[model samples]
Target: MYLHSVAAYLPAAIIDNAHFTRLNGLADEWIIERTGIRERRKAAPGENSNTMAIAATDAVLAQAPAFAADSIDLIVVGTYTPHDTIFTAAHAVQRHLGINEIPTVSISSACSSLLNAVEIVEGYFAMNKARRALVVVSEHNTAYNNEEDTIAGHLWGDGAAALLISKDRMSPADLLIREVVTGGAAPVSKADEAVTLKPVERGIVMPFGRDVFQQACTYMARVTQTLLDKHHIPNQELTYLIPHQANLRISLNVAKQLGLAPERAVSNIERLGNTGCAGAAIALAEVWDTIKAGNKVIVTVFGGGYSYGAMLLERN
Candidate 1:
């Protein structure tokens, strides 16, 4: 199926590298070198998931006026940081937009957050479960960052984006999808940081840079190749490739190893840092601004759970 339209909202607040370093006890050089991020967005203090989701959905729905807000059959909000544990971001967006009759749910997969969100939507369309759907993913937690967790702190930013998908726009042979393969070797966290922090705690945690890079590159590359081989789709024909905006080092390394030219890879990491779930979705939304009618798109993401996924789709 085709992505009917995409839209995003980066709040007015822009935090620069020097400010980040000074405020969080990090060095501009170290953060940039490791993550290829100079600066990223931080939502205003009063802003929360509900408000941002409304703004994001307004923008996304506007771009697809061909479909009405009432036509949305599914709303999947992929996120880790939420205003409250009880209020799912999807439901928040639904209520904000006055479209509460649809099915809504939240999915969290760390860096693979939005990718998993996309996969869920794909299933709905594939099974004739939904005609039109909206995927809203964002992170709104810069103030909640852990001071000691420098790695996660220095890399994350807050922003939200939405993607509108519809069946009417999809072409019969579009790389709609052949198969999806998932693999994560083991647990990165004990799921019991209670002695220190709760497993469900949404705040940042100090991540081992070396360990993250190793896990990301291995899992991303393996999953991507497995999907490619399974679909009989070659690596050379991919027109666009978007990776989870974890770090430019990890992104480029995966592309280089996968035989995709440097230009084929798309990134906003340098500018937006790691936007949690919205990383890959925002990257695709940015590219959507210039996409032609029938381009090939291959989206692969390596995320927070130490998880990774790949989707091979063609433009309608």
Candidate 2:
């Protein structure tokens, strides 16, 4: 399957590192040193994950004029933050897009949601179940975050991104996915509550920063390298390495271990922070026009559930 188009919509409100420093009584430089995030976007009141997803889906649909709404037989929304638990984000997107009732599903794999959605879409195409598919990801980090809590507040942002995939090649594809792989293993040692979000709670609990950092880097690198090795693609051939926008350090460390140049890794964490499921997709949309035809791009992701995956693609 090929990505016909991709688009992103970020909230207008900007929360810089200084805001977190002021609330938590930490130095501005300390936030930067730890997360490498200078600022992030927060959705205003009345703006939630579903609204952002609709906006992003509208933008993607507008871009792909050749693919009509009626042709979309599949809709997949990857998000942990939902406006309501009763209705899936995909259903709302389909309704707003004026498309008929189709096979719509919601994925809640935290950061790896988008990658997992792509994998599902690929399966639909391979099975000849969908001629065209719509994938949307909305992340409202501010909605569930506790600003008073120092750790999670500063590391997250709010945003949404959409991708239109098709087997018919309705328009010039942004990239043709060469291969996708996703898997994860439990921690060998006793696990701590590194991250948790309950339906009744306002936000998630994220302690054990050191453990999360170590595991994130290890699994992300492992999944990325496995995909590359399986396809016999050298690290040097990758035009850009887009890892989950969890932290700048993790992206840089993965690149360093793979012997990739610092410039080859695509990163927007310094500006947009970690946008959960929308991170990699947003990064790709920001650099879509700059990626020349035939350029190879690899997106590796690790989410809160200890799930991780990687996808290798080439601009068409």
Candidate 3:
């Protein structure tokens, strides 16, 4: 079990809760009380999900340059916010990678996009479906984040992560992909408003922060514990708990309930906030250096499907 490579990308624009408050009629205290979010990033003009994911993919592939794009047998992209209406994020990524012949698919678990990608790619390897693949994820949550809701506005960022998986020298210990689960109706917005064109002018806003919290907390904990018990891995032993950037408080509380120490649980929520499907991936990317060749990591995510999913992976 070995991880061939891991990489990520962050947009240049930064948005703090205070700055968002000026646009949305929400208060910082209210946002902080509910979600432990300080700030999030926004993708600039022409900087959509594809461009972001490409950056991370380049970095990860650079780490393992021996492999070529055409050599990748499968491509799994995680995202709810895609760049085009008709195109899957994975297809766009393949186009950008200049490798369109390979199979590609997109997973939209809101914040769990990356985990789902990992799960799918892992299954491909475990079931002997395909051995070499790229798991790519990028979420520009601010694309629809209503600057109006302090809860949602301050809790998102733009970032991406990519991991090249192979059966080669990535190390057997790093190749473990243990569990996967998902439950939800749809992760998209349920608002009555019609989908509009100009995303930059009016953001994609989620008005149901409280409901999201309740659903995410319960689902993340249940799936996380189930995976841990099934794999015989203890939360106490995991080197890092990479959670989808939802809110600071929610992440903290979930860690406490799972018996993981605050330090052991890694989060970029304070600085990066939530990048939706890319949340966990970006967080993991930032901490890529700290993880050794064989660190066991627990990646959990509860996203907008009202949907949630969780998985376990060993670091390469």
Candidate 4:
């Protein structure tokens, strides 16, 4: 499918490294050196996953003025942090976008949710079930963070990202998702104790930092290389490696394993922190303008639930 436009919404509250420093008595440089995150955005009161998704979708539609609201026949929201348990974020987004009676899907595969959402959109197009679709990912990481935990409490932020995917080109210069690959050999479920963001007495649990870190690098590198190999696209041909913005070290290690320079990878973790499902999309939206036409960009994501995937995109 062709990507019409991309947009993102980052909350205004900036939580810098100093917040963690004061909270845990760790040096500012220590956090950066460990996670490569200097600061991240946190949602303010009243801002949640649905609101952020609406903001991002509005921005995307504004960018592609010709793509009417009625044209969208499918909507997929990739999120682990939903505003309401009874109503999916996709329901809220569809209502706000003013589209009616279309099929809306909510996916919660942790970090790979965004890529998985795109994969779903691709499947609909391949089945001739949808001509136009909107895929959005939003996460309110701070809301579930265990504030007492030093390792994960300060490592998360909140943001949303949206993308317009269609079988037909919305613009002549649109980018195409040329290839996709998903799943893995890793036992992500067994590593569940290492990483989590689920209900635990009105809050969320987190991963054991050391265990989570080790597993992340291994799976991220494996899934990324799996996608590249499927397309027979050499590492040298990849113009950009956009991995989930969970950690700087994991991204760098994936690049190294793939035989690509770290500069070829795009990252916003230092400033935006981990936006969960929204990480790759938000990071991609921020640097969309810089990617040259015809350049090959690979987006690889590994998230909680042991979920992971990758996509090969080429700017048209």
Model 3 / residue 253 / CA error / Å: 1.2
lDDT of 3 at 169: 56
lDDT tens digits by residue: candidate 4, 1-316: 8988899999999988888778778678888888998999999999999899999999999988877878999999988888886688899999997888888999888888888898899889989999999999999888888656776777888999999999987776789888778774346545656666557555556657666667777877887788778888888999999999988998998889889999988999999988898999988898888888878888988877677788888986
Clashes of each: 3, 0, 10, 1
Task: Give, for candidate 2, the lowest lDDT window spanning 10 residues.
Answer: 184-193
What TM-score goes with each of the models? Answer: 0.88, 0.96, 0.85, 0.95
Query: Runs in model 1 with CA error above 4 Å?
Result: 170-184, 187-202
Better of 1 and 4 by lDDT: 4
TM-score of model 3 relative to the true fold? 0.85
How much does candidate 1 score in TM-score?
0.88
**In lDDT terms, how accurate is model 1?**
0.74
lDDT (C-alpha) at residue 292 in model 1: 59
lDDT of 3 by residue, 1-316 (tens): 3465677888888787778668866677776667667777789998888788778788788876666777888899887777875677788778878875667888765666676677787677778777789888887676766656543446667888898877555443344554566555354444122122245576655656565666666777788888888878767778888777877777887788898888877888877877777778777777767777567777788765556677677754
lDDT of 1 by residue, 1-316 (tens): 5667777888788777888667767888888887899988888878876567778889988877776888889999987777766787887888887876677888776667776777788788878989888889878756556645665667778788888877666433223543445544447542222112233665677445667677778778778777777767688877777877878998899889889998888999888877877877788888876665466677787765567788776655
lDDT of each model, Cα atoms only?
0.74, 0.85, 0.72, 0.85
Give the per-residue Cα lDDT of candidate 4 at 128. 91
What C-alpha RMSD separates each model from the true structure?
3.1, 1.5, 3.7, 1.6
